[model samples]
Target chain A: MSRRILNLILGCASVCVGLTPMRAQEFKLFERTVQVHGFASQGFIYTNDNNWLTMNTSQGSAAFTDFGLNMSTQITDKFRIGAQGYDRDLGQLGQYHPSLDWAVADYRFKSWFGIRGGKVKTTLGLFTDTQDLDFLHQFALLPQSVYPTDLRDATLAHVGGDIYGNILLQHHLGDLAYTVYAGHRSDSKYSGYSYFLTKYGVTSSSFAGLQYGSDLRWSTPLKGLLIGASRMNEEITDNGNLSLGPGIDFTSYSAVSRADWTNQFYGEYVIRKLQVDSEYRRYLHDQIVSPDSLETISDVRGWYISGCYRITKRLALGSYYSRYSITSVAGGAAAPFFPDQTDTSLPANHVYDKVISGRVDLNKFWSAKVEGHFMNGYGNSSFPDGFYPLANPGGFKPNTNALVLKTSVNF
Target chain B: MKNLRLLPLVAFLVLLAPVRARAAQVKIIANPSVSTDAISGRELKSVFLEEKNSLSDGSHVEPVLLKSGPVHESFLRQYLSRTDDDLRNYYRVLVFTGRGSMPKELGSDAEVVAYVAGRKGAIGYVSAEAGVDGVKTLAITDGRSPVERRVITRIEPEYPETLKRLNIGGIVRLQVTIAPKGNVENVQLLGGNPILGESAVAAVKQWVYATAPSRTRIEVSVPFNPQP
Candidate 1:
């Protein structure tokens, strides 16, 4: 026989011999269990205005298509590992990157507690952790007003070591389940866009921060109905150095309450607020704009109401209306950060936006969604400016309306 | 006058013969290895429903049931105070939730009797008239002195007949009192559908058994047959 055929035959014979019973009455030994699963999704997004779509920021709304692959495996009862990669084009910019999403060993003491040490993803809000794989959730895209960060980026989520647990309390008054986590998040400087900008001779900074968050959820059975309330808090440290002070440090708080009648009808309302303390620094061909500090404090408030109906066991339909507004206060004796900048007509920025979305679940692993956004106020645009090569665009014009359609799948 | 008197005497003897035979026909036996007296109906019901998985001696007990048909229906009604339909549905829910497994069903009373007798941990019920040897006949109710048959009506005058009809397939909860001589004295419907409640009470009252005294709660459903 050929060498390949000989090798194949030998392999099969070895496997058979390895599985043979060793003793006449002994129970079988040599156990093997293996499972393989993953998912891929790709979809196109178009914009009504090409210029709005082409705006460049860490994440911008541009018409493009993206796809990603994620695979995980349980090496044993206590250990799991996973990896994911995504390639996408947003308006004018394109990217292709792969990263380790989950590489952790979870030791579960009981049903309510576990300590996971390794690179772990933190789930804060309802859809915070699963923001990627848009196909798996109800919205075509994440709620931009709430999850303003890019879902495809690793820096937006958590990585590092975490200890998480849940406490369940049953009392005469009600039932409560609280989940809390404390962890230090670390990422390679290359995980953020600043690293790339810096490589291109543009002034940028490195970031590494600590995150601690907790969520308290309570549900009470009232006359055969379930009513629930939830509160969450997240705090992050300044991980970079800006000309003003350190880098932007922020604290976010969210509160939500919901009522569910049976498993069919449910309604929830959530409010989120973020406090940002940072400064704007100027650069002249990679030189500091000023030697003194120019501090800026920005605050954003957003909220939404959503309702969902499960039409069938594997199908559901939902709708949500949400709004977000941001205000920034600039302080310290400062000159126009960029003298070469052209759009000098603007003052301190503010933005207001409203979005209405509807979604349909096609299956447990897939969903389709469509949404329309009505933005009225102009705020600091997260776009790069053309006038000053180093000064990023800081404002966007208001009264822009756009519609989006998205689909996602997960395995 | 002489012929009429003779006819009356003969009628009395004929009626007494069947009653005597029925009383004599009742037999109780445990498996050869089992040392205890036949279980009471209440204990049997508890064992079959898994409310208790062990007997007084701490021996594990497993109940076998007929898969379907008249015997299954009769067994459930006589012991569980539930219709076969309701029992089957409840078991399905339990099995789905991993609470317990459905009892193994045999083909017929003969099979059920043989299986229960041969298996050390097995228990099952068959017709009082099956005349099967080896297996035991648990008393339907415990007491002595021919207990008066008392029909405990559960339905009010205003209950709908349709609901009453459905109650035939619904669960009937009853609290029963058995005398020390194995005679049933009183039964009260603790809960259940109002429609079939009367028939259930009536059927239970007519049940006769010979066993030790015991007071226990039981649920049984008596099915209605339009053809009968």
Candidate 2:
């Protein structure tokens, strides 16, 4: 089935290329062209907990891997299309799961304006939400906070449609470029054996959600340095049902500020929040527990600061520090079942993480990178409970560290 | 025995007298229409090097040269302090970069004289004995204080009796100072083909004195024909 799909994609690409008009005086059918390009990276990961390393459980380590492919073609003088897919393997048991990362067709009205339809990635906050994985300004491993575990895998990619454009402002003060966008998307979820048997008494349930987000970025020159600030908001509606009610409806707001000096030194700071109401519920066995109903309001807040230095034309070094904290206020009938049961008030949990990375450009079309991460305080909170149950207990140490190496090629 | 000795002595004196009395000959010429009193070697160098394209009378002057051979080599060494090989290589780079073109090269001294004399903007050099009616001689300078000497080699190749020509060989060194008006003011032998050095130097000095000074380097070359 996968081979068939790959063949179909290749066939479509060839047809697109064949349809292009050839240049004047040229015998070739197509002078203009389309291309498919992507990259894959795999590495070994060692964690503190042996149970977390599902592959070779006795070995006390895990292998991390990911790969993605993007196909882009110019359909006409004013129209273009692109589709992408990405897969990641947490461990052997988790296997390889692929997601339709993006599928969009864009019509450019002019040099500065455009409109797009189909499944599009939302331009929310900063970083890779709108751009592809390969175009990230930082390392492959993002600041853990802004890209939280739940949001990273839980949020849907390639939303329905979007309208986006940029405005250029050039002045004596400096030059400023602003990008704005609006879009909607659907979300999907996977269930574990225990959750599936105890909760809905089903193996899995696929749900679609409404996603809307907008981002505004402003850039200006101050003291001979270029500085910018951006703010974005996204809300997801839970249309699927749990025992207590519908799945948790949530809203996220993120803000980012950046300063660049002479294109040599750059620093950025970002803050994001994922908030859900108290009516949310999770079904376990014959009982239904309203995790949100017990709380007046609950939200997760995360932020990070990162800086990068260009060591040479093809090499760069960067480092970032990020922190995430979850806060909840308990109330109503379901308060006792929630974690931190001693207090009707929930104790805030925080995770502190730092990452240092280096990148080397092997050529115009190839690059390699290595990064190390140091995390402390709330290692138990990093992964989703349904994915890794052993790491949820409070007995485990809050600290964990890991290293990753990756390489990519594009043409 | 005494009479035989006198005949031998007189014959020896006759042969030695002309050898000792031979003075270096140099040629200098300008277009007949050019009313300027004379041209200095410095002014000539500036024009040939394209540093100054205008003459004293405000007429545009383009310098020409012989493409190759002993004359081309001798002339370039005497005035430009460069060899024909160096000039050709330099032009190759300049042309490739679209900076400039090489100077036009004529076939021989007669052709050079005829071309320069017939064209208003053209300037060229030839043997001292080749000087003709259409061209006039210009002054030259050795670039010494107090104007120590006036040495000019006239190329009257058609009238060999008018000038005694000698060939000196070695590298010729000439220092040229350009004036504010973009013309050559001073020409001095910096060092060269040692065999053609003296005649080359004298001719260059006289040429410097005859030309108007400008704020540009003007270095000219006048090669003496091989001694006949």
Q: What is the TM-score of chain B in candidate 1?
A: 0.50
lDDT of 2 by residue, B1-228 (tens): 865756664555345333312322234455666555345555566566543455545555667788566666656755554656345534432221111234557787788788778866666766555645576555444322112122232332121221222122222335555444333456654333332444455444444222333233433434434453
Which of the numbered candidates is closest to the native, going by highest lDDT? 2
Question: What is the docking quality class of candidate 1?
Answer: incorrect
Which digits, one per residue and each the tens of the lDDT, describe model 1 over residues A253-340?
1111111010111223321111111111111111111223334333444445554444454444555554444443344455344222
Deviation of model 2 at A180, angstroms: 4.8
lDDT of 2 at A198: 24
Q: After superposition, how far is residue B224 of candidate 2 from its true place, in Å?
A: 36
Query: Measured by C-alpha RMSD in angstroms, how accurate is candidate 2?
Result: 22.2
Q: Give per-residue lDDT, candidate 1, residue B187.
A: 69
* lDDT (Cα, tens digit) per residue for candidate 2, span A276-356: 101111111111223333332334455666666656757878787876555444455755654431221221255576888
